[model samples]
Target: MRSGYSELLGSMRPTSTNAVVAGEADPSEVIEVSVILRRANPIDVSRRRSVLTREQLTERHGAQDNDVQAVSAFAASNSLSVVKVSQGTRTIRLSGTVGQFANAFDTTIVNLDEQGAVSRALSGPIFIPEALNGVVVAVLGLDTRRVARSHVQLVQSQNVLSSFYATQIRDLYHFPPDLRGDRQTIAILEFGGGYQSADFATYFHQEGLGAQPSVEWVSVDGNMNVPGSVDDTEVALDVEVAGSVAPLADIVVYFAPWSELGWIHAISMAVMESPVLPTVVSVSWGWPETLWGDMAISAIDAALADAVALGITVCISSGDWGSNDGTSGQTTEYPASSPHALACGGTVLQSDGVNILDEVGWPGSGGGISAMFPPPPWQNFGYSGRAVPDVAANAVHYKIHFDGADAVVNGTSAVAPLYAGLIALCAESMLGSHGAGFLNFTIYEDFSAQSTFRDITAGSNGGYSAQPGYDLVTGWGSPNGAALLDVLETLSFAQVQLQLS
Candidate 1:
C-alpha cells in the first residue's frame, strides 16, 4: 500500500498550494467509478497474421461473461453496488460513498479548488485486491471533470498558410478526383460534437462534391451529438473534408463521452463493428501520452493493435501544437504515439490557388520521439523510440465548409480525414475488399522504396526538421496518388511472390 501510494504521488501534478476548501467531503457522498478489465486475447500476437472475422475476433477477444461476476463479487466484498457491467467494453461500474470508495481503493477523496470550479478526485493510490489486481486494468471516474483538449483550430492567419480548400489541396498533392473512394467507408471519431445534415448538404453542394452522401451517426458510452459552437466546428470539419475527398465513401461518425475512455471506446467500437466495417478510421483528437495513465495507454494501444489485425487503418492527427503538443512543455501525443496507428502531421502548402508552388512543414505540426513506446520493427530511422507523423498533409489555412459556410480552419485534425480518404481510395482501387492490411510494414519496408511518398526536403516543426526522407517533421512527406498506387501494385506483386516462394 505504501509503495503504491508513492508511485501515485509521482503521477499527480502539483496544483496551487492554497487549498481553499470548496466543500467538506461528506463521508457518505455517493460517486460512481468505472473499472476496465484486461481482455483475453493479446493484440501483439493476433495482428497482421490474418484479418480475423468479426465472430472470430469477438469470441476470442471479447470479455467473458463470467468475468463480470468477479467484479460483482469484488464490489459486494467492498459493500458497493454493481451498478452496471458491460460485456463488450469489459468495464464494471460501481457506486458507493466517498468513504466506502476511499476505503475500498485505499485512496482519499478530495475536492479540488480549481479556480471558480470545484471538482473531485482521488488523492492516493487506487489499489485493487490481489484477486482482482491482474484483471482490473484501470479505475476511471476518479476525477469527474478533468477534460482533454480537442485538437481543432480555426485558421488564425491567412498570410502564414495561404487559404486553401480540400479540393485545391488534394489536387496540389496529386489525389485523383475520379476515384471518389467508392466501395469504401470512413469512420470519423467525435467525442463532444454534433453534426447537422443540412450543414453537410450545404457544405457538399457548395464544394461541388454532390449531395446525399451516405453518413451514419453512432453514439457510444451514452455520448451523443450535442450541438454547440466549439463542438460543431470540429465534427463538421471532419465530415466535410472526408466528403470532399472521397465523395462516394460512406461516413460513420462515432460520438462518445469525453476523456480517455471516450476516445478509446470510439476506436474499439469502430474496429469491432460489423455490417459497417470501415477501411479507414480518422481521429482528430488526442492529448499528451503521459496524461493518459499507464493503464489507459496500454488498453487503448491493445485495441489499436486489433485494428491493425482487422485491416482497418486508424489515422490520428499528431496534433497542431508542434513539439510540445499544446502542453506546458515538450511531450508526445497519444493515439499518434501508439505503434499500431499512423500519426498524421501538418504542412503549409504554397500554391497559386490552382497549381502547386512549394510545400513546407508547418511549425505547428506535432512531431517528436515518443516517450511512451519503443520504436516498432518497421521504424528504421535510427530513432531510439517511436517517432511520430508517418505522413504529412497541408493543414494551415484550410478553407473548409463548416456549419453551413466556408470557414478557414487549421490543425492536424483536418489532416487525419484527408489521409483516411486516401486510404479508402487505395483500398478500393488496389486491395479490393481485403483492404490495406496494417500499412506500416509495407510503408516502411517496401513501398517507401518505390518513391511512394513526396519527401519534404525542407522546413521544421520546432524540435525536428524535414529532410530528404523520414525526418520527424513532415515524415515521408505528403501523398502522391500515382506513387501511392504504384506502392500498392508493388506490394500486391510481392505478396504473390511470397506465396509462390
Candidate 2:
C-alpha cells in the first residue's frame, strides 16, 4: 500500500528510535504485537479466619501427656495424616486435600471454641509428589505441638567455607584478582524476620572474614521489620552465607510480610524497583506453585524479565523436601519451577576435614521438570523432561558457628543464599559487561562446551536420578568455579571479537 520512496524512508529509520510524521503511513513492520495474557488470581478468598489457638485446644482437651500424641490424635480424628511436625513452632503438617480438611474441621475443630482462632486450612499447593507421577493432591499445616518445645542451641563447626566456591568461580572468570576491590551488591529476598547483628558479628569474627558487610532492610508491602528470634535462623543463614561469599559486596535484605501474596509482591517489587537492582537476588522461602494463580505467575515472570533486562540474576531454592515433598505427588515447587528464574538445588560436600572426597546431589534437593512451564530456550540441550537444579552448591549438614543458636540445623535454605553470594562474585568480575540478561544462556552454552562444570553423575532426589551431562537432577552439574570462569571469560572475549569482526 506504500510507494517505493515511502517504504525506503521506513526501512531507513532506526529500530530503537520512535518517530512518527503527520499523515505518514506506519511501517508494516509495526504490525500488531501479540500480547501474552496475564495469569488469573489464585486466591479464592481475600482472607479467612485463623484456626483454633494452641492454648484453647490444650485447655479443652486437658493437656495431653505429650504434644506429639495430641497431634496424632488430632490428625486421626480429622481423617488426616501427619507428615512432619516442627518441634519449635508446634506447627503440624497434615496430608490430604486442603479443601477437604478445611471443610471437615471448619465446624468441629477450626471453629471449636469462641476464643480460639483458626487459620485457614489452605493446601500446601507447592508440594508436588513425584511418586504419584504427578497425580495426587497434598496439603500442609503447622503442627502446634512441635512449636511449643522451643529450644535452640548455637555451635561452632567448619563447613563455613562452602560459600567461597562461587567467589572462586568468579575470580577464575575475570575481574583480575587485583580489581576485586570494586564495590558490588547482593540482594536477599526474605519473607520473615530480620538478622541478629550480634550473630553476624560473631560469625565473621569466627570465620576471620573481618568486619561484616553493610546490611539494610527494605520492607515490601508493610511486612518489613525485625523478626523475632524463632524466625531469625533462615534470615541469619542468608545474611551470613551471602556476606561470606561476597565479602566486598554490600548486602541488601528485602523483607516481605508473611503470606503468599506478600512474599511474591515483595520479590517482584525488589526485582523491578530496588535502588541497587542487585547483581543477584537470593530467595529461600517458597510454597508450592498451585497456591498461586496466573496473575502471581505473570508478575513473577515480568519481574524476572525485568531483572534480565537490567542485567540482574535471580537465584531460588528448589525446596527442602526431596522430589516427593511428602505433601502432594512429585511436583516441582514454585518460583523454583518458574522457567524464567534459575533454580539452585542442593548438594552434599563430603570431606574428611582436610581432603574433599566428592560432591553429590542431596536426596532432599528439590528438582525435576516443571509440570506447568515448558522447557526454556536455553535449557534445550538436556533430556526432554523438566530439568531442574540448573546448578548446585554445598547444602547438607554444613557446619557454621551461629552466634546465639546451638545445633547445626541443616536444610537447603542455607544453600540458596550461599550460591547467590557466589554469583555476585561472578557478576562483579563481569562488571555488567554481560548484561545479566544472558547468564542463563551462558550457563547452558558453557555446559555444552563441557569445560566449566563437574558433571554430578550419581544420587537421586526421590523419583528422579542424576546422570552424566544434563538430567532432571543436577542440570549441568556442580560448578567448577575456575573452569566456569574460564568459559565465561572466553565467551566475553568472543563477544568482543564479534564486535570487532
Candidate 3:
C-alpha cells in the first residue's frame, strides 16, 4: 500500500502544459493545473503524522511503567535517538534512518485511533542535531516512514488582534485625493495559495472602495489557480491592503510553489517575463539565511537586480521572529536580508479616535546587518551605517477582513504589501509626469530629502535599535505616505523645471 501510495503521489504534478507565461500573458489567459494535494483521510494511519503525547497512546496500551519502558526500549533498539524527551507533553521526538526499521515499526504506529493498524509516521528527510526547528523525523531505513517535523507552535487565529493603530499612522500622512488616480498596476507575489474572491469583495466594500479592482494570478512552475487547501490568510491580507490603498491599480498575484528552487524560478520568471509590468512586487515569506546556500541567495540577488533595472520596486518582509527567529541568538531571515530588495520592517502603531498617538518599531520585526551581502551604494546615506530595513510601515497586528472572516495577523508580511500599495500611488503620480526610470533609485534619492519620510525615533528589534533619521531597527522609519507622494510630485516638478530651463 505504501509503495502504491508513493507511486500515485509521484504522478501528481502541480504545473500544467499550455500554461500562460507569467509577466507576459494576457489577463484572459487561463491555465489548468493541480493546485493542491487532496486532503488525506484524517484516520489514515499509513500516512505520516506528528508525534502525540504518550498519554494519547496509553489509552490503547494501559498507562504503566512497563509499557512506557517497552516503547523506549523498542525505539533504542532501532537506533532511534530521542531528540527531546518532554515530560510535560509526554511526547518524544525520534531521529534515525527510517528505511532500516520500516518493518518493525510500520504496523505499530497508528494514526489517531484505538486500533493498532495505523502508524503515526512523518514524511520527509531525517536530519541530525535533534532540537533544531523544521527537522525531519524518521525511522531507521524506512524510506516511506518519515515526516517533516518542526517544533514551532502554530499560532492560533484567536490570539491575533487588530493593530488598527497602524491605520491611523497611515492616515496621518494622507495625500491629496487626486493621487489615487495615478496608480496603474501593483503586483503581489505568493508562494502558497490564492485569495478567495468573496473575501476580497467583502473587504473592499467595507473599506468603502467601490467596485473591486481586477485580480489575477500569474502561474510559475505550475500551481496557478484560485484559493485552495493551502493557507491563504497572508495572501488575502496582501491583496486587501494593496487594493484598499490603490483601488485603481490592477493587482497581479504571482503564485508559485514553496520550494527554494521553485521560488527562485518564479521570481526570475516574474521579473523577466508578467503581462502588465508591476510598478512594485510585495513578498512576505522568507527563511533564515543559514538555511539557504550562497547559490540560492545569489540567484535571488540577481533576480532582484533585474527587477530593479526594469523600473520595478521589490518590497520584502524583514521576518516576524525578531532577531532570534526561533533560533537561539542573533540571526536574520533571508531575502529580506538581501541588499537589492527594499526590506520593510514593522511598527506597533497606537492611536486615539482621531489621531495617531505613537508608532514604534516592533521588536519582533526582523532587522539587522547582513553577514552575507554588504550595504549597497544606495543605503550609504542612512544613519547607523549598517544594512537593514530600508523602510517600515504599520505591520503589527493590523486589522484586515478576510474571506468571510475578520482577523488580524502581524509581521512585516503586512508591511511589505502596505508599502507596495503606497509605491503604486507614488509611481502613478510620477511615471506619467516625471518619468522616474527606476523606482528604487528614486527612493534612494529621496532618503535624505526632508519631506520624504517620518523619522521613527524609538523602539528596537533585539540586537539593533531605532533612532532619528535612520537606524537598523526601522530603517528610514515608517512612511508618511501622503508626504511621500507630495515629495515625489515635487521631484517631478523639479525635473520638469530642469528640462524647461
Candidate 4:
C-alpha cells in the first residue's frame, strides 16, 4: 500500500510555475532540515481551564523515544548529522549536504529564481522508508521558497479617510483604564524584515508614551533584525501597535526566514522555548489555505494546539484581501482558519477622541469558511467548516513608524497585535499567573461575552456582509475592552473554582 502521508507529499509544491530553475544546488554545501514526528496522543485545548507545563505536555503528548531513535538511526545510515532533538515539539534537526539529502529523500534539489527572489527548491517527491512511514509526518527546510505575505498596505494620500496614532486607537477602543498589561509578555512572530530601536524610540516618544515598553529580539534559524525590505513596514506596525497599547508589557519579537520550516520554528520557539514565556503570541502574516500544502498546514495547526494547551493565547490576522483572500472562490487564510487561533478581522473606524462615531467592516477584511479545519464546538453558526475571524477591530488609518519615517497603513495586520495587546491586559486581570488560552468558546457561548462588542451593522468584505449580530465580515464586531475584562474576570473565577474542585 502507498504511504498514508502520500497526499501531503503530493500536495506540497516547492514553488509556483512562475519560478524558473536557475541551477543545481551545490552538492557539498551543508544545510539543515527539520523533521516532524507524529505524537502518540493527540492534544485538544478547547475550553480547557487546566494548563500544562512544558515537561508535563512532553511526557503526555510528545513523540515516543523509539520514534526518535528510529529517526536518528535513519539519519546515521543516510550520513546525516543529528543536530538537535526536542521531544516537547516532536522535532528532530538534521544537517547534511545537498547531495546526501537528495539521495535520502529521492529528489533533486535546485536553485530557482522567482521574480527577483532566489530560492532553493525540491523538484520531486520526498521518499520515506517503509519502516518509518507512519512515524515521520513532515520534512521542512529543504525548500526555501517564501511561505506567506504580510497583510499590511499603505494608504494612498488621496484615499485616507481617517488616521490616528496607535495609542489613540487603543483608547478609542475603550481598553481597560487601570490595566497597562502589567507583567504580561506578548510574543510577535516575524517571517522577514526587522525593527530598529531608534524608530521604536521615536514613535513612542512622539505618541507621548512617557516610558517605552521593554523589547527583546530572538532569532530563529539565524534570521536577525535586518531592516530596509518592504516587510519592514509589517515589523514596525506589529511592534509599535502592540507596545503602545500595552506599555508595561514585555514585547518579544522572533525573527525567522520566510519559509515553511522557519515559520514553524519561530512559533515553536516562541511558545515552547522562550526565556520568558509569552502570555499571548501575535501573527500578522499568512497565506490562503489553497496555497499551503496539507503537511505544512497540519504541522502548524498541531503547534498552535500545543500553545493553547499550555495556556498561551495565539492571535492571527485573518487576511486583508476581502472574503476570497486573493484566491478564486471564497477562501480563508491558514493559521487564522485554524480553530485554535483567535482570528482577528478588520474594520474602518471614525472615532471622536473618546467615542466611536462610526465603525464598519473594512471592504478588504478577510472572512469566510475554512476548507481545512472543522469548526470547534464553540462555533455554532451552522457553518460546515471553521469560520474565518472570531473578532474584529479598526484596521485602516493607523500611524506607524516604518523604514526610518512615519507611514499611514491599513490591514487586518494591525488588528491581531491590537487584540494581542488587549488580551495581555485581560490576562493581567486574571486571578492566577496563567495566560488567557483559547477564548472562542466563551465568546461564542456566552451572551454576556457577546454583549461586550459594539455591534457593527454596516459595510461588507466583498462576499460577506456585516450584520447586527455575528457575521462573516466582522464576526462579533469590535470589542469594548473594559467590558470584556469584566466578563473574563468572572470566567476566570469560575475556572479557578473548577480547577480546585
Candidate 5:
C-alpha cells in the first residue's frame, strides 16, 4: 500500500481499452475539479413515498458546514482556488494547475490518447489527508476521459424493414387516454449532440400530435447542444420519442460533457438544482460496471438514490450490448445496475398497424446480474446481486427525425424516454400528493401492478432468456399503460387513506 496519506480514494484508471500513454500532462495548465462531499444525513429510499422538497433536502441532508470548511482549508493550504460550493449536491469546486493538483492528491498526471481523442488520466488511486477522509467522496475532473457511450443504433435507409411512430407505440401499449402529462416535467440527460426545433415541429406535425411538447435546454459544465455530431441520432431519438408520447409535458434536455464529472453534474442539475424539478429523469448513456471505477459508480448511484428520495423517478437504458454488455462475461450496466433506477430493456415488436401481434426480447438488449450492487429490498428473485432490467419496451425500428432528416433508429436508448413519457403521464393522475417515487417496488411487490405487464416469454440476449414471470433478458416485459395507471391510482388511494388513518 502507498504511504503518506490517511486514506486512498479508490482506483482512477482509464476506462477505454484503446487508451495509450501519450505524454505527461502540462504542469502549468490550470483546471477545475468537482469534489463530492458526503451527505449530512443518509438517504433512506424505503421512505421514498415521503417526498422531500429541495429546501427540505438541503436542510436535512445537504453537506455539513464543517466538511465544507475542511475542504476549503485543505484547498487553501494546497494553493488551489475555490471556485464554487453547492450544499445541495455537496459538491465543492476547486481550481489549480496540474502540478498543484498532482501534489495535493498524491498522484501523477499523464496524458492518454484513445484513437484520435485525447484526455488526462491518473496513474493510481487518489489520496486525501486524514482530516478530509470521510468528508470527501470523489474528486472528479482530474482525469477527463470519455466515460459513457450513447446506446443508439441507426438502421440504414435501405435496410429499414419497419418503423412505428412514437405515438403508435403509446397507443398500442394501451396508455391511459386524456392524460397528456400536464404539470409534469421530464428531464433528459445528453452527453453530446443536439436537437433542432424544426425537426421537433415537423415530426410532431407528421405524427398528428395536436401541439408540440414544450422543450427546454440546460447546459452543464460548458457543454451545449451542438448539432451535426455523431450523437445527434441519440439526442433526437430521446426527444422525439418522449415528446411525441407526452405532448404537453415540459421536456428539459441537459447537455453535459462525456465524463464522470459531467454525469454527476447533469444528474444533480435535474435532481437537485433545476428551477422546475422534473417528475422523471431519462438516461440513454452508460457502460458496463467493469468499465467504471468503483468509487465513481458509488457516487453516481448515490445521486440516483437521492432522486428517488425526492420523488423523482429515474429511467435508465440497460444498454444495447446484450447480456454481456459488450464484455466477455455476463454483466450488467451501471446506472441501470443501480437498484434505485428503473432499468429499461429492449424488445422487438411485430405488430399490425392497429393491433399488437407479438413482442420478444431484442437480441441486443442488455441484462443480467450486477457484479457490484446487492439486490434491493424490493427484489425477491433469490439472487445475491441486483437483477435487470426492471422493464422493457420496443427498441427496434423507430421512426425519428434528426438533423432535418427523418431516419430509422434502434436501441435501448429509445426505451428510457419512452418510459419517461409514460411515467409523466401516470404522474399527472396517480400523483395526487406523492410522486411516483419508485415504481419497481410496487411492480415487484404488488400483484395488480405486476399484472400490468404483457409478459414476454420468448427470445434471448445471449446468456439469458426471456421467461414468463421475470427474466434477465426483458425483466417484467413491456407495459400495459392503462392497466398500470389503474394500479397506481389504487395504490395512491391506499396511500392517502393510510396517511389519514
Candidate 6:
C-alpha cells in the first residue's frame, strides 16, 4: 500500500515548471532546514480558570524525548548538523548540504522566481524512512515561498480616521478604568519589519501617557528591530495601537526573517514558557491555508495549539481582502484558521466627534469558511468549516503615528492588537499572577448569553452578509467592554463546563 506521503507529494508541481536560483541546491552548497516532530499525545488545557499558572501550563505538553532523539539521529545519519532544538515547540533545526538533503528526503531541491519574489522549494516527493512515519510530521525550509506577509493596509483617504484614538476607543468600549492592563505583557509577532523608539515616543507623548509603557524587542532567527525606517508600516501600526490601548502593559515585539521558518520561530518564541511569559500574543501577518503546504500548515497549527494549551491568548488578524483573502475569492487565512487562535476581523466604525456612532463590517474584512480546517464545535451553528474571524474591531481607519506624522491606517492588522490589549486587561483581571488560555472558550460560552457584543446587523464582505447574532462578516459583533468584563467577572471555566455539561 502507498503511504500517506504519496498524496502530499502528488500535489506539488515538478521542478521543470519553476525557475531555479543560480547555483542553488548544488551538491556543495549548504542549506538550513527545520524538522518538526509529532507529539506523543494530545494535550488538554481546558481548565477551571481562564489562564493557568506557569507551572501547570509547562507540565501539560512538550516533545517526547524519543521523538527528539529519532529526529536528531536521522539528522546525524544524513550528515546534517543539529543546530538547535526547542523542546517546547517540538522543533529541531539542522544544517546540511543540498546533496545530503536530496539523498535523505528522496527529492531534488529547486529555486523558483514568481511575481517579484524568489524562493527555494522541493522538486519531488519528500520521503522519510518508514519507521519515522508517525514520529516525524513535517520538514520545512524546503520551500522559502511559505513566508508570511503582514496584513496591514494604508487607507487612501486622509484625515477621515485621524479623529479616532486607541484610548478613546477603549473608553467607547467601556473598558473599566481599574482593569487597564496593568503589568500585563502583550507579545506582538512580525515576520519582517521593525519599530522605532522615536515613533513610539511620539505616539505616547501625544496620547499623554505620563510615562511610556515599556517595550522590548526580541529577535528570532537573528532578525533585529529596524528602527526609524520608512518601510514596515505594519509594525508601526501594531506598536501604536497596542501602546495606545494597553498603555500599562509591557510590549514584547518578536522580529524574524521573512520566511515560514521565521514565522513559526516567531510564534514559538511568544508562547514559550519563559521567565517573562506573555499574557497575550498578537499576530498581524498571515496568508490563506491554500498557499501554505501541508508541512507548513501542520507545524504552524501545532505551535498554535501548544500556545492555547499553555493558556496563552493568541490573537491573529483575519486578513484584509474580504472573503477572497487576496486571491481568487472566498478563501480564509491561517494561523487564523488554526482552532486555537482568536481570529480577529475588521469593521468600518464611525465615531461621532466624541463617541462611536455606527459600526458595520468593513467591506474588506476577511470572513469565510476555511478550506482546510473544519469549524470548531463552538462555531458549528454558524458554519461548517473553521471560520476566518471569531471577533472583529475597527479596521477601517485609525490615527497612527508612523514615520513621524499621524496618518490613517486600516486592515484587520489593527484588530489583533485591539483584541490583544483587551485580553491583557481581561487577563490582568482574571489570571493576575497566572497567564491566559484561549479567550475563545469564554467568548463562545457567552455567545448565547450575549454579553459584550454590538450585534452588527449591516454590511457585508462580498459573499457573506452581516446578520443578527453570529455571522461570517463580523463574528459575534464588536466588543462592548463593560458587558464583556461583567460576563468575565462572574464566569469561570469550571462554571462554563458545568453549564455545558
* Order of candidate numbers by lDDT, starting with the best: 5, 4, 6, 1, 3, 2
In model 1, how large is the Cα lDDT of residue 403?
57
Residues 322-383, model 3: lDDT tens digits = 76655666666778877667788887777665666788888877877677766566666543
Candidate 5 TM-score, C-alpha based: 0.97
Clash list (residue pairs), candidate 6 = 311-436, 311-437, 375-385, 375-386
Which candidate tops lDDT?
5
Candidate 5 lDDT over 202-275, as tens digits, reads 99988889978999899999999889988999998899999887888999999999888898999999999999
How many pairs of residues collide in each model?
Answer: 0, 37, 32, 0, 0, 4
Q: In terms of TM-score, how similar is model 1 to the real structure?
A: 0.88
Query: Residue-wise lDDT of candidate 1 within 1-501, one digit each (tens)?
Result: 734332322223334444444654667888777777777665563224766766676667766666777878878888999987765556677999888877777777678776765766556557767666567777776654344556778655535445765767778777765678887889988877787787888776776666345888988777777776677778887888887788888999998866655666677678765467788999888877666667567767777876877777789889888888867767888888888888999887787867668888988898899988888878877877898888888877766555566677778888899888888877877754376766666677775632767778888877778888787887778888656866776777777689789
Every model: Cα RMSD to truth: 3.4, 21.1, 18.7, 2.2, 1.4, 3.4
- Models 1 onward score TM values of 0.88, 0.65, 0.65, 0.95, 0.97, 0.91
Q: Per-residue lDDT for 19 in model 4?
A: 85
lDDT of model 1 at residue 101?
Answer: 78
Question: What TM-score does candidate 3 reach?
Answer: 0.65
**Candidate 6 residue 89 C-alpha distance from true site, Å:** 1.5
Clashing pairs in 1: none
Q: Give the 10-residue window scoring lowest on summed lDDT in candidate 2.
A: 142-151
- Better candidate number, 3 or 6, judged by TM-score: 6
Per-residue lDDT of candidate 2, residues 224-308 (tens digit): 5575655576777777777766677788888765543454456555654556556678887776554444434543454455455
Whichever of 1 and 6 has more lDDT, that candidate is: 6
lDDT per residue for candidate 4 within 424-501, as digits (tens), equals 988988837474566776788889999999888999999999998998888999989889888988877887787689
